[model samples]
Target: MPITLPNGITAIELADDYPALQIETADCSATLALNGAHLTHWQPSHTAHPVIYLSPTAILQQGKAIRGGVPLCWPWFNAHPTDPDSHPSHGVARIERWDLISATVEDGSAIIELELKASPVIEAHVPFPFQLKALFNLGQTCSIVLETTNLAKENIAVGGALHSYFSLSHIDNATVTGLQHTPYLDTAARPEKSAVQTEGELRFQAETDRIYYGSDLPARIHDAEWKRSIVVEKAGSLTSVVWNPWIEKAASLGDLPDADYQRFLCIEAANARHDTRILAPGSTHRLETRFIVENLS
Candidate 1:
């Protein structure tokens, strides 16, 4: 059976694998996978390429993390810093399904909300009581707001990222701007090294994994070959992670095509490292980011 929202958004199971919501507006269309409340695709009517990228062989199984789009990393990131081997990487949010709360259309845009609360599956791992909600405003630009509320009486530590994979005409033709003069941890370096970015624009040549600190500015992806640029803006985040699996790493991944790394870049809005939040009981923290594609010519 198909589920229809009051604003005519359609919810249907995809490939008998997982439930997804479809949103169409006068300006754009998007697909949201409920398993992670993940925004898988977004395309403005005027753009030639999609603003987001989804891997061709991405796994859509119920408890598996889809390989692309925006995967929500929450509660903790990458792994628990103190107990790396004891916790799941990127937390529990991306592997669980979220409930659609509402979907509405206004002024040629689609506004949607999805919610997730702590359950037995989640408690079995961390045992922290919390409520997570995501609000999406999709149109010519796509914006998302993730709010996490602590339900327990004590304070809770949390960190996360909107692990966004953006499409590019070619990795060599893309450069990310706005992180100039920022300091970052080079994760690809042996034992990890800290460095300052002196280059005004960051270009890709090899495997890249750097966590930039204290970044509150909007970053821009200039795709010279595509003649377009993608502007990424964010709030409530003090860190930005830039990554690309360049060759050997990409080949080892089962879900992503080896050569697919040449077509996308991951510039994420994150609250990791020294910026992790400690939420007081009854308090809420919202992490938001917006993506807008513009023609260069």
Candidate 2:
């Protein structure tokens, strides 16, 4: 029998392949994949375009990372900074399936909680006992909270990100604000140069990859073509990242179409690089981000 959730939400199998929970409310609708606790679709009422983007050619199989829509990069971000030959790049959380703990509706919003515990496979990669909990609130706005607790006897260092891909009408027409005057590492530059952003707003014209340090303020993506603004606010994070594969690099990604770069932009909230968290045994750390969409006149 299919699982039943509060507020008339339904648990259904997607393509007869993976189990997923469907959330519907007066203001929005969403789909949460059981594997990785991935949220693949979210559409607020009265919006023409989805706030979150899922790649057209994304693989949804077990033990694979879906190309878009807020993939959780836990324990580590990107490749292992110390190990050049680390496999699978961004940690093991996104590939491991998560268990749904509870689902409920409160104040007209659908709230879902999922959990992941360390196993033999996870311990082999991370070598630390840990438990992860993800809480998602879907309404007119989307809020996500990720909490990690160190279950090991010793302190553990952890770094990760909420890799969010947002839909856009055109990449060139969008301007991201609130990161001005921040120092960032330009990873696309040869040898990875560090620089301070002088521009009042960031506009995309080429392949970009930058990790902004000490950025705790909310970032806003204003899309002129779409006549909308997406504001991303966060807590318990000190670093933020912005990335886009413009032309040549986009063509090289197997899960993403070559021309799909024009339709989305990624503004990730992270604790990566020098901001890695050192959690004491039995201590818990939480990273949270909220997304709100506003219509432009």
In order, the Cα lDDT scores of the candidates are 0.89, 0.88
After superposition, the stretches of candidate 1 with alpha carbons farther than 4 Å from their true spots are 1-8
> Which stretches of model 2 miss by more than 4 angstroms?
1-3
Q: Candidate 2 has what TM-score?
A: 0.96
lDDT (tens digit, per residue) of candidate 1 on 1-297: 333585536777765869998878788988999998999999987788888999999999977888889998887777777887766778778889898887888887888888986788788666678889999999899999989999889998889898999999999999999999999999988999999999998999999999999999699999998899999999999999999999999999999999999989999999987889999999999999999999888
What is candidate 2's lDDT per residue for 10-125, written digit by digit as tens? 88886457888888898888888887788888888867789999999988888788898889888888897777385467788888888888888887688999998777767778
lDDT of 1 at 75: 75
**What TM-score against the true fold does each predicted structure earn?**
0.96, 0.96
Best candidate (score: lDDT): 1
